[model samples]
Structure formats: structure tokens, C-alpha cells
Target chain A: MREIAAVFLSTVRMNFRDRRSLIFMILFPIVLTLILGTALSSVSGSSDTAEKLDSRAALINQDHGAMAGRMEKFFRSPEIRKIVHTKTYRSLSTAKADLKKQKLDAIIVINKGFTQAVENGSSKKLDFITSGDMESSLIKNITQSYLQRINAYRAAAAFAPQPAAPLLADHALSINGKIPRSSDYYAVTMLIMIILYASAYGLNVVREMNLSPIGYRIRSLPVRQINYLIGKTLGQLATVFLQIIVLVTFFKFIYHANFGSNLPFIFLVCFLLGFIIILLSIALALLFSYKMADTILDLAIPVATFLAGGYVKLSILDTNPIAVALNSWLPNAVAQNLVFQNIYGGTGQTAAGGVLKLTLIALAILLLTIAALRRNNHADLSK
Target chain B: MIIEVNDLIKRYKDFLAIDHLNLTIGDGELFGLLGPNGAGKTTLVNAILGLTAVDHGTINVFGEALSTSERAIKKQIGLVPQDIAVYPELTAQENVTLFGKLFGLRGEALRKGVADALEFTGLTDIRNKKPSQFSGGMKRRLNIACAIVHKPRLIIMDEPTVGIDPQSRNYILESVKKLNDMHCTVIYISHYMEEVASICTRIAIVDKGRIIAKGTQEELGRLIEDDQVVSVGVTAPDYSIIEKLKRLPAVKDATVDGHTIRIVLSERKLNAVLDTFLEEDLTITKIETNTPTLEDVFLTLTGRALREGAQ
Candidate 1:
């Protein structure tokens, strides 16, 4: 442990001394966030000027059930009223006609048997009719996400092991109608981009520790190889956390971006994401030679950025059967959504889901790294 | 014995790196492993350091077998590799301190050890300077300092002076002698014969992954004791004269350069070989007959110059 600590301190000191690369790692993300956010906001002008949706929406309550009435009440509440101007219409045909005539951006139809579907622990589909504009899709996603949470809780209750003990309570998050602004989304995406670049930094740290003569010197000492590797990893993690602290604080105070009321949770997600990035970097370094590992890290950042919606608001697997098959599970995408949902007050489950996903990735990468390191250790022994 | 290797063998893929090697170094001996490039000098050092596993052998260091007591054994040994192994980003002090810590030194002891190592290497005034800014000689000294900061019972230096100015090389050689005086066993590896001859108490000439000869300078020189080397400096030498000298019954080998012909013959045949050079009508400006040195011993054993790569 002492040897590990020594190596850790030494590696951290070296990283701090390398002022040029350190500056690049810390400054690049914040600058890109500002530039991208400003450019996106300008391109996507306000509703009045862009001829986009005006938040005027209509609702048709076909199921005269209690659940349907509750849904109607939610749409009419002042909380949702901030984002949506909704009017309950008697006829679905009239609401559809109004939506077509541009009087309403979208029409929400509470499907028949919606109340029974909720009470009987069955699924209910909410029909979201729209002209497929960005605002309409945003509203649909928000409403659908809320309903999905309710369904999840119901399913948990139904699957409870005992009669008296229930798994979850009937809970609905108060719709603040405060979606993440362009700055907030951009902040989170930029954060992902920055963290993904941690892989590059990680590769460099590992390369220095493994490929360089310094590594041979260390190996010749009493220090174990495992301790050396662990120390280097901790050093890289420290730098990443430092970058995160700077970027997060900058976004919070300077841009006034909302990361929910839970700052610790935001940090938790960031730390997990950082772990994933560092592990990936180490794993790649161990698996490939120096030049090949460098090539992979250089190529991975931009590709991961694009897939995680850093360049545009489109996921790599936006809509396809493979989306479900693959979980559209890019590490950066999971990281971006983890922050995006928390900032916008989406489902709380997203936090747990993100933790689970990142933890699994971390575990997998760690195992591969361990295997590679062991291979290297054995090979060295044979030398 | 500080280190003992019995019939050690190390193969890289299909090539033998350490072929059935056996060696024993007594305590406080400044042993030298002399070899040219690609002569498996580093490989032998790696085996002794336990950096490489042997195919078949038993290595006992500090009276304990390496296979079971690697860390404990490693704690008793220090390695100064041929390459400059100090971290370029770290100051001389930090580099020494880091290695010192790896050897389980801490607190006041580590501080004192690092300071002592820096002072010993004559780097006290520039301990805070990074090795990247250091001259080649200073870097070499810093490399030695890092290895000795832990103060192990035995220190192994591999080619510590491959490329450096004469001043630094002299300083390093003096430091090695100083280390031996301090009762630390030193294994100095190098290809330079004169450097080893000057300092090493015992020398081992390695080639093609095997020790070809091992002894003191006087002891190894005796390998060619029965033969005499006659160096003749001639003007406008002809290749036909060398061939004629080889035809002499007592001449073992004859080779000529632009104006000099070196002949190895039976000690009794020196007068006869000299007469043949005169018969070839060679203008002998200089004639010197001397006993064989380590280089001649190497050539007699391997039929190649000591400075040429075995590969």
C-alpha cells in the first residue's frame, strides 16, 4: 500500500508538472460548451420568429375514467400551463382539425380504458398526435416519460411478494414544465465530450507507466505491478475529477444551469462516468501497443461525441430495432442522458439506471484490464 | 555468495537468450559483465533481477531462492539499467525519493537516504532540476543515484557509461569504486573492455547469450598465453605478404591492415615470422611483440573482435 501511494503521488505530481497538456484538458470543454450552446440557440430561434410550435395544445378525454380525468387535470394545471396552453375539447375530430389548422401544436388523446389499464396493472398507450415538430416531440417525450414511471411503479406493486408490503408508492413528480435549456443540455453534452477525452489522458498516463524506461525502473524496485497500475489509475482519476469540478462549477454559477436540486447526485454521475472513461483508457492501453492504443483513443473521442448527441440532438441509434437490442448504450450517451434528465426533472429512475449501466461497464472494463495486465505480468516474467 | 545462478537458460521464442549460464558472485565483488551489443548482457542481468523467468535454472540471491522470495530478494537488490530510467518530469530529488519509497524507506530515513544519494552523486546543488534538462553525464549520475537511494546490499549497473563525456564517465567509474569500498556488491555490465579492466575485480566475457570467458584481467589474458602477437607497421604493404606469413609453419593467424600486419604465432616462432616479413620485402617501420590482452583472449576464443556485435 505504501508503494502504491508513493507511485500515486509521483504520478499525480508528474501530471501537474505537465502544464501544457493539463491546460488543454481543462480548457477545451468549457470553451466548446459555450460556443456550441450559443450557436445552437441562434440557429434554433424563438417560437414566434421561427414559426415553430406555440405550445397551444388540445386534449380529448375519451375514457371518462378516474385515471383519464387525472391526466386531464395534470395537463390543465398551472404547472403544465407554463409550457402548454391546453384546452379540453368535446370532440376528437374538432381537436384534430384545430391541430391541422395550426391552432394547436399537438393533440393528446387519453385512450379508452386508460383508467382500467392503470387499476388492473396493465399497460396503457397514450396517443400523441402532432405534426412532428421539435417542440411537439419534446412534449410527447416528457408526458410519455412520466406515464412510463407510473407504469413502472404499478408493475412493481403488482409484483410485490406479500399482500401488505408494497414495493413502491403511487408517486407523480410535479411537472415543473422546465425542460433543460439549450445551455443546460449543451453543458451536459460538453461534459460527456470532455470526460470521454479522459480516455486519451488515461492512455498517456498508462503509456508512461508501462512503455517508458521509467516503468522498467519501477518494476525493478520492490513495488508490485498491481500497485503501480492502481496508483497510475488513481492519478488519472484525480485529474478527471478536477476537470469535472471546474466545468460543473463554471456551468452552475456562470451559466446558471440547473442540475436539479441534488448537486451530490450530479457529482455521483460524473464520478461514475469518469471511472468508466479511465477504465476504458487503461484497458485499451493494456490490450494494444502504444501507437495502436493512441490511435484508438484519438478516434474514439469524436465518434463517441457524435453518438452521444454532442454535435446534434440525434442518437446514433435514434430509431431502429437494434436500438432496443443494443440499448443504444453508448457510454457517452448514457452519461449525457444521466445529466440531461436530472437537470430537466425527468424520471428519478434515470439516475439509478445510469449508475447501473456505468457500473456494469466499469466492471467489464476492469476485468479486461486485469486480464491484460496479468498477461503482461506473465510475459515480463518470462523475459 | 550474494548471487548464484546454476545452469540458467532463457529462450525468447526459438532463440536462446541465456544459454545454460552459471555464475556466482561473492559478496563485495565488483563483478563486470563484458559484452558487445546483442550479446545478451541485458538478458543475463534481467534474469538475475528476476525480471525474466528462466527456462531451467535455480537462482539464489542473498541465500534465498528467487522463485519463492521474489519481493524479499528484490528488497536486497537494486538495478541501474543500461537505459536512462529516471522520470524526465521528476526532479532529481523526487526521482530518488520515489525509488527510495519503493524500497520501503519513509519519513526521515527516506529523506536522509535521498539526500545522501544526491550528495554522493555530486548532484546536491541541482537536486531540484528535472532530468530532461540535465546533461547526458548528469542524467547518468541521476540514474545511479536513484538505484542506490534505497541502499541495497547489492547493486547491478548495466552499461552505466555507454554514451557520456570523459569527465562524467570518470566520475561514474570513481563512484562504482566508491560503492565497492562501501561494501556493496556491484555487478557492472558494459562492452568497454578497458573500463571493466580498470575497475572490475572479476570479469565475465559474454557472447551469443553465453559466458565465453571469466577471470581477472591477468587470468583471462593467459587464455592466449602459449601464443605471441607480433604487430608490424609496414609501408605500402602487400596482401600477398600476409598470405605468405600465414603459410609459415609456426604462424597460427596473420591479418593485415593498410600498412600493418598482425601475426599470432607460437612464442618460439616469433624470430621465424619476423624473417618471413623481411623476405616478403615489406618495409617494417615498427615491430612490437607483446603478451595477449583481454581483446586478444576474446578473439582467440570466439574468432572475432570483442567490439563487434555477436549478432
Candidate 2:
């Protein structure tokens, strides 16, 4: 145990002392975050950005179930009235004509059996017939948020101490009908980017690791390889956490960056991503030579970061078909989207599902690292 | 036996690193592995440490099979590599403490071991200093301090004196002797003949991945009691006279370099070898007779290419 702790602490100290790693991991991300956030502050959403959505939306509820009636009541409530001015119509054709005439910003059609589908836990169709997706996505998120609250209310009402309401109107307004300011957007993405950069820590330690001269003295001790490896991973993981914490705290206090209220989930995503990168870089440095691993990292990290929209949101995956068709399941991309959705209350991507996906990636990288180390026995690591 | 190896063979593709070598070190023995670079000194050491896979060998450390009991065996052994392996970012005390802790020392034992290690290596005054702030000699001492912090039963020093000044080298060498005196078995590996001869109680001359000669310093000197080199400098070293000198019964082999005729011959029959030189049509410009040291015996045995007289 002492041996493992020693290795763990020593690895952390080594990583911190590695000037290049420190500059890239901690300092680079902070500076970039500040520059990108401040310069592009007005782009995402400025002072006039949070203006009312006021999208003239037509609500055509075809289902006679109480659930569909409740949806109608929600659209007429003051909460939805503050965002979308809803008008009721009996036929889809009439609403479609009004949408075509530019009289309505969107037409939301609740198909029949919506209540039955909810009760059966089956898929329910809620169509957003709007030409502009950017505007419709917010109203759609509000409607989806209402349905989720209904499901939760139903689940919780089975043993209710009191007959509580089916939904709280505030959740439907999670989007606040406005995208974040550039300062807020970059603040979150830059933190994610720093988590990705923590892979340098893994590369540095594994470069000296294994049975090489620099590591041979450590390996020569009585400790087992597994303990040494675990100690290494924990140390790198801790460094990543430290970097994230320091950056987040600095950005929070000094820059007043909008990290949203969901700090725990945001941090969870960062932690998992940090773990995957650390293990992945370890596998890279072990499977390949240090120089080769470094080259791969240098080539891969920035490209992946760009694809994940770390530098700037140049091409959104939803809008750009080519970007969406890339078929790469980038953990950073998933993490960013997950954080974005959780904060603004977008489509129903359960936090558990995203976390599990990141966890699976981490596990796979851990396995790869193990396999790499197995083959790396007797292989020179110092070079 | 502290460590015993039998029929160890290690091959790297086409090149053979350790060639069916064997070695044994007794308790409290200051054993020396003397070899030039690539002579398999490191390869053999790696095999013993279970770092390299051997094709055919059984290494027993502390009466336990090395392969089956590597961790247990390593727990009792400390290795000081040829290169300085201490972390440059860590302080002298931290480096020693980390190594000791890794070897299972804790609390008071850990603290004492670290302090003792620093004191033993004469680095107590700079315990808080990093390797970047230290001289090469200080770094070398720090390297040794890291290895023996746990006070292992056997300490393997692999050319620990290389690249350091004479004073530092002497200090390390004396430290090796003192460690052995404290009943810690020391494997002092080096290619420097004088250092090995002066310190190691039992020295093994390694060449071509084999122990060419291994014994007490006095015993190895006797291996060449009858061996002597006679150098005769001539104005014009005739290539023809070299063949004539070789024909003499006492002269084992003779060669001429520049303008000097060198003969490897028995000391008792030196006169016979010299008589031919007098008969030659050349005046003996200079003549010198020198007895062979253990290094000469090694060079003659291995027939390796030149290093002057160092190896």
C-alpha cells in the first residue's frame, strides 16, 4: 500500500513539474478560454439575446386523453405564454396554411394515442412543423421537458404524501428561449478541452515507466505491476481533476463564466473524459514508442478537439450532415452535447446513458492499456 | 548463495547477448562483473532481475527460483543502474523515501531508512535539493541513495562510478566496501580494471557473453604468471622478421605495429624469443618487458578489438 501510494504521489509530482505538460494542460486552456470567451462574448447571446421566443405556435391536440388535455393547458399557461404565443386549431391543414403564410413560427401537432403511448411507455409522436430548426428546437425542448416532468410526476405520485401537481411549469422554460453567450459557451468547452489535454500527464509518466532504466528502479521494488499501474492511473486521474478544478474555480470567480447550474454533471462528464484520455495516452505510449505516441497525440488531440467544436462552433453536427455522417463517437463531443443538453434542457438524453457511454469508453481504453502493457513487457519505454 | 545462474542464454534476434553463462555470488561477497560494453554484463543482470526473458537458464536468488519468486527475490535486492535513475524533480530525501516506501518501509522505519540512506551517500546536507540543482557526482550519489534506502540484503551496483569525478568515484567505491562490511552482499559491476581489482573481493572478467576469468584478485593474477609481453621497437619493423619470431617455440604469437615488434611469450622463455630479434638485421631501438594484468588475460581470451589496455 505504501509502495502504491509512493508511486501515485511521485507520478503526480512528476507531472506537475513537467513544464511542458503544465503549460499545455493548465495554462494553455485558461488563456485560450479567456481569449475566446471575451472576444466572442457577443456571438452566442448578448444582452438583447434573451428576448422572448414569442414564436406564434399552433397547438393542434388530436388526442382526447387527459394527457393531451393537460398539454393544451400547459401551452395556455403563463409560463409557455411568456415564450411561445400558442393558438388552438382543430385541423392540421389550417395550422399548416398559417405556418406557410408566416402567421405562425411553428405548428406542434400532438397525434392521437399520445396519452396511451405515455401510459404504455411507448414512443409518442410530437411533430414540429417549422422551417427554421434553431427556433423550433427551443420550443420543442420546452414541450419535451413538459412530457418528462409528467412521466416523473406519474412515477412519483404512486405513493405521494399529497396530490402534487403533474408538472412544474419552470422546467418547460429550461432553455430560457436563448442560447448562451460566447463567454459561457467557451467557458464550458474550454474546461472540456483541458480535461482532454490531461492526457499529457499519462504520456509523460508512461514514457519513463515499465522496465526501462528510469522506471526499473521503481519496478525493482516489491510492488506488483498492477499496483504500480493503478497507482499511476489514479495519479494521472487526480492531476486531471486538479487541473479541471483549478481552471473551473478560476473561471468561475475571476471571469464569471456561465457553467450553468448543473456543475456536478458537467464535472462528471469531464472526469470520465479525463480518465479515457489518460488511459488512451497510456495505451498509446505503451503500444507505440514515446516519440510515436507523442506524434499521434499531437496530430489526434487538436483534430478531435476541432471536430468536437472545442476551438469554435464552426460546424454543428445537427446542421451539417457531413459532420454528422463522420460516424466517430468522440467522447468529448458526447460530453459537450451532454453538458449542453443538461444545462439548457434539450432533447431527452438521460445523464445516465451519456455517463455510461463515457464509462464504456474508459473501460475499453483501460483494457487496451492492459493489453498494451502485457505486450510491452521487456520493451524499452524510456526512448 | 545470494544469486546463482546456470546455463543462461539470451538472444536478440541474430545476436546472442548472454551465451550459456553461469555465475554465483555468496553471502557478504563483493562480487565484480568486469566487462566492456555489450559484453552481456547488463543482459545477465537483467535476466537475474527477471526483466529479460532467457532461452535456457535457472536463476536462483536467496535459494529461491528467480522466475517463480521474482517479487520475493527482488524485495531482498537493490539495483543501482549504470544510468542515474532517480527522479530529477524529486528532492534527495523524497527520492530515498519513495524508494524505501515502495519496498514496504513505513512510519519510523521509513523515516530512518531515508535519513540513513542520505547520510550513507553523504547527501544529508542536500536532502531537500532536487537533482537539477546538484552536480553530476551529487546526482550519482542520489541514485545510489534511492536503491539502498530499504537496506536490501544484496546491492547490485552497475558501473555506479561512471562519468563522475575521481573523488566521487572513490567515495562510492568506499561506500560499496563499507556496505559489504556491514554484511550486505554487493555486486560491483564495472569495466574499469583498477577499480574492480581494488574493491571487489571476487572479480569475474566477462567477454563475449561469457565469464572468461573469475576468482579472487590474487587468483586471477596467477592465471597469467607465465604470460608476459615483450615489445621491441625497431627503426624498420620487417614483416618478414615477424614470421621468424613466431616460429620460436617460446613465442606464442608476434605482431608488428608501426615500427615496434610485439611478442606474447612465456616469461621463462623470454630470452629465446629475444635471441631471434638480435639475429635480425635490426637494432633494438627500445625494449620493454611487462607482465600481464587481469585485463590483458581477458583481452587475450576474448580476442576482442582494441581498447588500448583499459578493458
Candidate 3:
């Protein structure tokens, strides 16, 4: 136990001493919280009193094909205009400038060969540009849903001369009743994103215990492999714990973000996310080289955040069961949704279930990490 | 013997790293292992530390079979890796204490062990300073300090003085000698021929995954020759004296190069050779003999300079 404590303390001290990376992790999120909290304040409000803000979007139609004409008609159509106010632009650059300047929330561009590509079915990419995610998410979703319907209707029109106009799908992706005060909402979300970045923590700490030159020195000592693992994992957890506390305190007091009364539960959820990140890092470290593992997690974190609706209101195919399950089950999304649900007026059933799911996921990652370590025990980790 | 390896064979795919290698190291012997790059030195070290699994052989450290329960076996072993693996974030004392605790030194024992290590490495005064503030040689001393805090029976030093100043290099070499004097077996690996030649009691030259030569410095020097030449420089090279020296028993040949008379003998008979020159009433201004050094032995056996590995 003493040996384990020594290992654990060294890891924690090493991490704390790395002032550069730690300061970045703690301060970057606080900065983002200030910017995002103020920008999305009205749109992301308390679940009950949170009212949707008016959304604005621009459409640029450069295609001379028949399908391009229908796409322009869909944007100008009265149904999409009810939820999202749409403007028509003759030039793509003008629409892009308007979006970048914040005059528009989003801009959807349809390239020149829209009808020809739709007919031949080679490749079609709808470019969605947004200044900020909160208001733009609504416009992006509507445009995408319209595109999905266009493809279905275009095929149907080929088989049987269909109606004269395209129609909006019967279903719409809604944000549901989970919008909390934007400052508090971003405070929680931005914190979760930074904690998920803990995925690299294990790579840094584990490298010292092995893989680095230090590993050869330490591994030759009297300590057992298991002691090194326990000490390192605990130390990483302790370091991450310190980082989350500082950020959470800053969000709650300095930034005036909301945590409701469930600060303990909020911390619990964030802790699980941090644990999973460390475990995932260890798993990757055991399986791959340090550079490879670091890169994989570096690329993976943002993608996970995007899918979790962290950057914007994720309303893509939300009506479908698969989409709903995937969005609600992502580690970041689940943690974020639970905090919002707890702060707003919601039963404990959803939060309870989400906690269970996250706990299971963390456990699974822990098991996997141990397995990888054990499998690679006989192999040399030195350079 | 404190350590034994019999016919150890380790292969990575088609590359045989340790090819049926056999070796034994006795207690209190300061063993020097010399090898070129990719000569299986690391593999052998890893095998002894129980870090690698051998294909067909056995390694017994402290008279016990090497196995995964190496916790006990590993406790008696210390390693000073080639690189300065000390944690730069830690103070000199903390680095020593942490490693001591890891090696199972308790409160007071741990404290004393740390103090001893720091003092021995001359780091007592700057024990509070972090390694980041240290010079290259200071860092190298701290590296040894970390390894010795636990006082293991067997310590393996792999190029511990590779890039340090002369003072630190001498200090490190001194520490190795002290460790051996205390009856601790040391396996010293270095590319520096002079360093190995000056310290190691018994040296082994490994090449291509096998021990090509192993013995005292003199024994290895003798490996390439059965006889030695004696070169005597005199003011005058008279034919009578040269002819008389060549006729002496056990003298293979006596030849003249400028003012030097070169004599070949099947064995060392320095007195007889000198007596012949002294009896001739000749003024011997200079006398010279060629003795093989560790560098020559390594170059002769491996056909490559040992420092080639360092480059």
C-alpha cells in the first residue's frame, strides 16, 4: 500500500507541475463558457421558461438544374419559414459574408450541378455554414431534412408523375424540453468537453511508468506491475479531480452559470466522464504507441462532442429510434442531458438511468484497460 | 554465481536477438559488457530482469528460477538506464525518497537510504533543487542516486556516463567501484573503452547475440596472440650484436628498423632481451613494447570500433 501511495503521489505531482497543459485545460473552458454563455443566453434557457429564439438562415442556389429549383422553392416554402426565417441570396459569397458577420445564423449552399448529380447519384454535399451552433442548429437541421425529403420525392417522381411541389417530412427533430439557462447550460457542457479531454491524461502518466526511458528504470525496481497501475490510475484521477473542481467553481461563481442545487450529482456525472477518459487513454496506450494513442483521442474527442450535441442543438434524425438512442447514449450527451434534466423540473428516473449507463460504460472501459495491460505485461515497453 | 543463464534464445520473428547465449556472473564481480549496436545487450539485460521471455533456456537470479512473480527478485535489482530518467519535476531528495519507498524502504529506513544516496552521489547540498535546474552532470549523479537508494544486491548500469562532463564521469565510475567494494555485484555496460578498461574486473565482449570473448583484461588481450614482440632502440645497430641476439635461444628473430632492434619471443623474457643489449656495451636510448588495450581487443574481435555504437 505504501508503494502504491508513492507511485500515486509521483503521478499527481508530475501532473500538477505541468502548469502549461493544466492551465490551458482549466482556463480555455472558462473562456469558452464566457463567450458561449453570453451568445446563447436567450436560446438555451431553463427547461420550463426556456423559449426558442427566432432563427435566421440564408440559401444560395447556383444550380441551373430542375432539382436545384425545387431546393430553392423548399427554402422559400411557407412551412420552413414558420420555424426558420429563410432568405434567398443570388451570390454564394454574399451569403457566406452575412453568416460570418452574424447577420444570419446559417447559410445552406447548393452547388451548380444539383439536378444532374441527383439524377446520376454520384455525390452530393450540402454545405452548412453557421456562426454559432445554438441558433444555426435549427436551420441546419431543417435544410438537411428538406434534402432527405427531396431525394425521396425525386425518386418517386421518376416512377409515378408525383405532385407539383415538395413537402416537409411528417417528423421534425426538436430540442425537447431540456434547454436550461444558456450560461449555466454552456457551463456544464464546456466543462464536460474539457473533462473528456482527460482522455490524454493516461497517455502522459502511463508513459512515465512505462514506454519512456523512466519506465525502464522504474520497472526494474522492486515494485509490482499492479502497484504501478493502481497508483498511476489513482493519481491521474486525483489530478483530473482538481481540474474539474477549479473549472466548476469558476463556472458557478465567476461566470454565474447555473448548477441548480445538484452540485454533488453534477460533479458525480463529470467525474465518471473523467474516469472514462483516463481508462480509454490507458487502453489506447497499451494497444498503440504514445503518438498514435494521443492522436486517436485528440481526433475522437471533438467528434464525440459534436455527436453529443455539445457544439449545437443536435436534431439530426432525432425522430428515428436509432438516432435518439445514439444521441442520448453518448457519454458526453448523457452527462449533459442529466444535468439539464436535474436542474429543470424532471423526475429522477432519467437521471438515475443515465447514471447507471455511464457507470456501466466506465466499468467496461476499466476492464478493457486492465486486460490490455495484462496482455502486454510480458512485452517490453522501452524504446 | 549470483546470476546464471544457460542457452537462452530469444527471437523476434526471423531476427534472433539472443541466439542460444550462455553466461554466468559471480558475486561481487564488476562485470563489463561491451558490444556494438544491435548486439543483443538490451535483450540480455531484459532477460535477466525477467522482462523478456526466452524461447529455450533458463535464467536464475539469486539462485532462483526467473518467473513472473519477479516482485521478490526485482526488489534485489537496481537499474541505471542510459538516459537521465529522473523526474525533472521532482526535487533531488523527493526523487530519491520516492524511489526508495517504491523499493519498500519504511519511514526511518527510507529516510536514511535517501540521505545515504544523496550524500554518496554528492547531491546532499542541493537535495532541494529540482533536476530541471541541474546541469547535465548533476542530473547524471541524480540518476545514480535514484538507483542506489534501495541498495539492491545487483545493479545494472547501462552507459551511465554517456554524455556527462569528466568530473561526473569519474564520480560515477567511483560510485560503481564503491558499490562493488560493498560486495554488491554490478553489470556495467559502456561504449567507452577506457571506462570499461579502468574498472571492470572481468569483461565480456558480445557480438551478434553471443559472447565472443569473456575474461580478465589480460586474458582478452592474449586471445589474439600467442607471442609478443620486444622493440629495443639503440644508438647503433651493429651487425655482430644483431646476429648474436638472433642466435639466442627462444628469440624468433631480431630485425633492425632505423636505430631500433625488434626482437620476437615466444614468451615474455624481458630480462634476457635487456641482458643481451646491456652486454653489447651499446647505448640504449629508447625501449618500447606494444600491449593490446581493450579498444584493440574489441576492434580485433568485432572488427568495429566500440564507439561506433555510440555514434
**How big is the positional error of residue B39 in model 3, measured in Å on the Cα after superposition?**
1.7
Error in Å for residue A138 of model 2: 12
What class would a CAPRI assessor give candidate 1's docking? medium
Give me the runs in candidate 1 sitting further than 4 Å from their true place: A44-176, A324-328, A381-383, B230-291
lDDT of 1 at B56: 93
lDDT of 2 by residue, B1-311 (tens): 99899998888888777888888999999999988887888888878787777888899999999778787898889999988898887899988888888888889999999999999999999999899999888999999998888889999999898899999999999999999999999998888888998998999988778888899988887877787877888988778898888788776667677988777775557777667777876877898887777666665666442244324
lDDT of each residue in A1-383, candidate 1, tens digit only: 88778888887788778887677766787788777767656654641211232467788888999978877887777666766678888888998888788887777888888888788765466676776554564555456655755565676777844222111121122122445566676777788788887786678766766777777777787778888888888887887887788888888898776666777777877888888888887777778876787788788778777655576653123333454233336777676767666666554334686779878888888898889888778866443
Q: What is the lDDT of residue A115 in candidate 3?
A: 82
Model 1, residue B191: what's the lDDT?
84
Clashing pairs in 1: A383-B52
> What TM-score, to 2 decimals, does candidate 2 have?
0.78
Query: What DockQ, on C-alphas, does every prediction get?
Result: 0.51, 0.38, 0.42
Give the DockQ-based CAPRI class for model 3: acceptable
lDDT at residue A274 of model 3 (Cα atoms): 85
Give, for candidate 3 chain B, the lowest lDDT window spanning 10 residues.
B302-311
Q: How far is A359's C-alpha from truth in model 1 (Å)?
A: 2.2
In candidate 1, position B116 carries an lDDT of 95
- Tens-digit lDDT string for candidate 3 (A252-298): 78777677787889889888988988888988888886788898888
Alpha-carbon deviation at A162 in model 2, angstroms: 23
